[model samples]
Target chain A: MKGIYFLVILALVTAVDIIVPYFFIGGIASLAACYLFWSALTFAVIVFAIIYTSQWGRRS
Target chain B: MKPLYVWIAMLGWTAIALWIAAAARKKMRPGASEFFIGGRRLRGFVSGMTYAATTYSAFMLVGLVGLTYRLGVGALGFEMTYLIFTVLLLITFGPRFWIVGNWYGHITPPELLAHRYKNQWVAVIAAAISFFMLIPYASAQLMGMGFLVDGITGGSIPFMIGVFIMAGLSGFSALYAGMRSVAWTDAFQAVTMMATSIIALLFTLYHFFGSPAMFAAEAARKTPELLKFTWTPELFIGLSLPWAFFALTNPQVSQRMYIPDSVVSLRRMVIYFSLFGFLYTIISTLFGLEAAIVIPGLENPDKAMPHLLGKVPVMLGVIIFVGIFAAATSTLGSIILTLSSLFARDIAKHFYPEIPENTERWLGRIVILLLLGACIVFAWFQPGLITVISSMASGGLLVMAPAIIAAFFWRRATAAGALVSMGLGGVITAVMYLANIYPLGWWPSVWGGAITLLLFAGVSLVTTPPDDADRFISSVERELVARGFRRH
Candidate 1:
C-alpha cells in the first residue's frame, strides 16, 4: 500500500521475471506454460499495485 | 494484398483523426504553455489513454512482434519488466512531478530540472540532448509507417510516400492544437490499436488454429525453440535495462506526469496506463509467438508482422495496418509536440525574454513543421548509421535517469553534477554503441546506468548543492502530503 511495499513488490516481480526464464528453460510444453504463467504473474503484481495505490490515494 | 484496402483504411482513418483535431482546435486556448500542456486540465481517462498511446508505439506490434518472434519468451519477460518498472515509478514519482508542476507552472520537464537546480544551462543542455536524440527516433516511426505501407502495397507505393504521408499527418496533429489535439487523437488511436490487434489476434487463433490452446499446442509442436526461454542473460539485460527506466527518461511519456487535472486523476492515469500496457504487451508478444508458428524461417525477424499480415484476409490486414499507422502517428505527433515545447520554452524563450507568449506559441508551431521535415528527410535518406543510432536510442536516453531520479530524491544533487552525468554518460554510451564496444559482455544501458549513477553521486557530494535544495524538496514533499500521498 505504501512506497516501500510497492518497491518490494517491484523487486520481487522483476527477480522472478529474470530468474524464472533463466533457470526454467524447460521442454516446449513446460516452456509455453512458463511463459504464460510468468507473464500473467508479472502483470498481476502491477494490477495489485494499482489497486493498492488507488486506495492509498483515496485515503490520502 | 489489397493495396487499395490499405489506402482506403488510411484515408478513412486520416479523415477521422483530422475531424478530432478540428474539434480539439475549438477548445484550444492561446499561448505556448497552454498549447503544449493542454493548460494542464486533462481528465484522468484522457491522460491515461494518451500516455498509453504515446508510450506503446508501433514498436509493440512491429519491432516487438519481430523481437518476440526471434527471441522467444524472453521478449515477453523483457516487455513485462518494463511495465512493472513503469508502474512502480509512476506510483513513486508521479505525485512529485504533479505537485511541482502545479507549484511552478512548469511547461516542460527540463524547465523543472532547471528550476530545481537553479541553472539555465541545465534546461538548455537537456533540451539540446532531447533534440539530438529524439529526432531520428521519431523519424524511425515515420520510416516504420513507410515500410508498412510499402510492404502492404507491394511496392506500388514507395517508401518515401509513406514517410511523407505520416510526416504530414503527424505534423498537422501537432500543429493544430498542440497537446490537446495530439492527446485527443492519441486516445482514439490507442483504442483503434488495441481493438484491431485483439481482433486480429483472436482471428489468427480461432480461424487458423481453432482456439488459443490449439495455437499454443501447434506452436509447441512446431517451433518449440521459440517457446523455450533461451535468451542469454547479457542479451536480456542489454535490451531490457534502458526500458526499465523509460518512465523517467523518455520526456514524451514523462511529461504526462504533469498533465492530470487532480491527484485522483494522476492516480487514474497510472492505473489506466498500467492496465492498457498490460493487455497490449500480452497481445503484441502473443502475436510474435503466433507468427513463429504461422510463418517460419523468415529472413528478417522484423518482417514477421508484415508476413503474417499477408496471410490474413485483406480487410483484416488493412485494418491492422491502420492500427500500426495509428500507433506510429500518435507517438510521432506527441514527440514532435513535446520536443517543440522543449525548444520553445527551454531553449528559445529562455534566450529571448522579450518574446510575447503569442509569438512563443507560433514559434512552437513552426518548430513542429521544421522538426517533421527533418524527420522525413532522415527517414527518406535511410542512412546506414541509423541502425546504430536506433539501437542506441533507449540506452542513450537511459543516461538521463540518474539526473532525473536524483533531482527528486537527493537534495545534495548539484546542477553541475546532473549536467555532467547526462552529458558525459550519454556520449560515453553512444560512442561505445557506435564503436561496437560492449564491455564485460553487458549492454550499453547497464554500463551507462552504472556510470551515470556513480558520476551523479560523486559529483554532487563534492559540488555545492543548489541554494534552495532543501526548500524545493521539502515544499514538494509538503505539497505531496497535502495531496494525500503519505510520508513516513
Candidate 2:
C-alpha cells in the first residue's frame, strides 16, 4: 500500500512538471500549481506513514 | 546621506541575536548530540525557521539577485527548481533520516555515511569535502555582508571592518550556544527578513506603479526585455539542475533532518519549509527586478539592490539594511555551527578517541574563532563578486551530491564507487571550469554535478554493492519500526 501511494505521488508530480511548462503557464499560476502539488504529495506520504505504523503496532 | 538610525538598528538586531544565543547556552549539554542536533528537542516551528534561514542566505539575496538582474526572469527557474527537489527529499528520505540519526546517535553526515557503508574512509572523505567546500562558501557570506554594510552606510564602514564585525559576532554566537543558539536566533532573523521583504516589495511597487495596471504598463513600456525570459539551453539545464541536486545533497540541509523533535514534527516542518522557500524566492526575485528597473545601466550588476536602497527614504533604507544583515548573519551562524561540528566529530574524534566531551565542545569553539579569522583574511585579500565565489563553492560540493544520494537509496552503491565518482567528478569539473569547456560558459557546479551523477551510476552498475548492504537496510528498517513507521 505504501509503495503504491509513493508511485502515485511520483506520477502526479512528474505529470505536473511536464504539463505546466508545455502549456506556458509562467506567472502566479505556475508557482501556485507547483507548490500545491508538492505540499499535497508530502502530506499524502506523511499520512501513509502514520497509518501504516499504527496498524503495525496493533498487530504486534 | 542619512542619519545613523540605520546603523543603530542593525547593531540592535545583532545584539538581539547574540542575546538569544547566550540564552540558549544555558540549555546546552556537553554531549555531541546536544551540540550538533540540539539534543532532538527543537519543535516544528523552530526547525522550520532554522531550515528556512539556513537555506535562504546572503547567497539568495545578493548572489541570486545579481544573477536575475543579469539574466532576467529566467533565473527564477533556478530558484523554483529547489522547491521540487526539497519536497522530494522531505517525502522520500526525511523520515528515515530522522529515525536513523536518533536511533544510532549520529551527529554529522559522515557519521551516517559511515553507518551505511561500514567504512571509516568513506566518512572521512565526505567530511573533508564538506568542510573544505563549505569554508569558501562561508567566506562568500562574509564578503556579501561587507558589501551590504559598505553600501548601506555610504562608505562609513569599510568592507574589511564590516566583514570582521559580522564574522566575529556570528562566530561568538555559535561558539557559545551551538545548534540551540543558532536555531532560536534563526527564528528571530526569519521574522525580520519576512518583514523587510514585505516592506521592500510594497515600496518598490509604489515607486514604480501604484496599481497592477500601472505596473504592467510601466513594465511593458520601460523594460519589456525583463519579461522576455530567453535563456541559453545550456544554462537552463546546467544551472537549475545542479541547484536542485545541491538542495538535496548539501550536508547543511541534510543535517536538519537529524534535529527535528519527531516524525510528526518533521512532517509539519516539510510543509512549512516548502511554503517558506516558495514565497521567499518569489519576493526576493521581484525585489531584484525592481532594483534593476530603478537603477538602470549600473556598471556593477551586483550593486543593483544596494544602489536602489540608497535612493529610498531613510526609514526604508534602514529596514532593508536590517534585512540584509539578518540574511547574512543567519547564514554565518549556521556555517560556523556546522563547521565546528565537523571538526569536533569528524576530525578530532578520529585523532583522539579518548577526548572528554566538555573539552571537545570547547575545542569546537576555538575552531569557530580560527575559521572567523581565516574568513576575514580571505575576505580582505580575495574580495570578488558573490556570484563567482558562490558558483565555485557550489561546484566543489556538486561532486559529492550524487554519491551521497546513492549511498542512502541504492543498496548497490559501493564505497569504491562513491570515492571514485566524487574524486574524479571534482577533478574533471575543476579542469573543465578552468579550461572554459561548457557552452553556457563553464560553471564548476554544472559540469561537476553532471559528471558525478553519471560516474556514480555507471560505477554502481559495474561493481557489486557494499558487503553490508543488507545489514544497513535492515538497520534503517528497524529504526523506522522503532519510530512508529512501518517498513514497506
Residue B393's lDDT in candidate 1? 76
Task: Return the DockQ of model 2.
Answer: 0.15
Over B1-488, each residue of candidate 2 has an lDDT whose tens digit, in order, gives 35367558767888888888888988887687788779988988888888888878887777777776776665665566556656665666776678778778888877777777666666777777777677777888888878777776778877877788789777877877788998898888887888897888788688767854565566556655664445655665566555665555567777888888876667666666776777777777766666766777877767777777788887887887788778788888887787777788877887886888887788888888888887777778755677666666667777877666666567788777787777788778767765667745746677687778888888878988778887776676666556555543
Interface RMSD of each: 2.9, 6.3
Clashes (backbone N, CA, C under 3 Å), per candidate, total 0, 0
Residue B152, candidate 1: how far off, in angstroms? Answer: 1.7
Cα TM-score of candidate 1: 0.96
* TM-score of model number 1, chain B: 0.97
Colliding pairs, model 1:
none
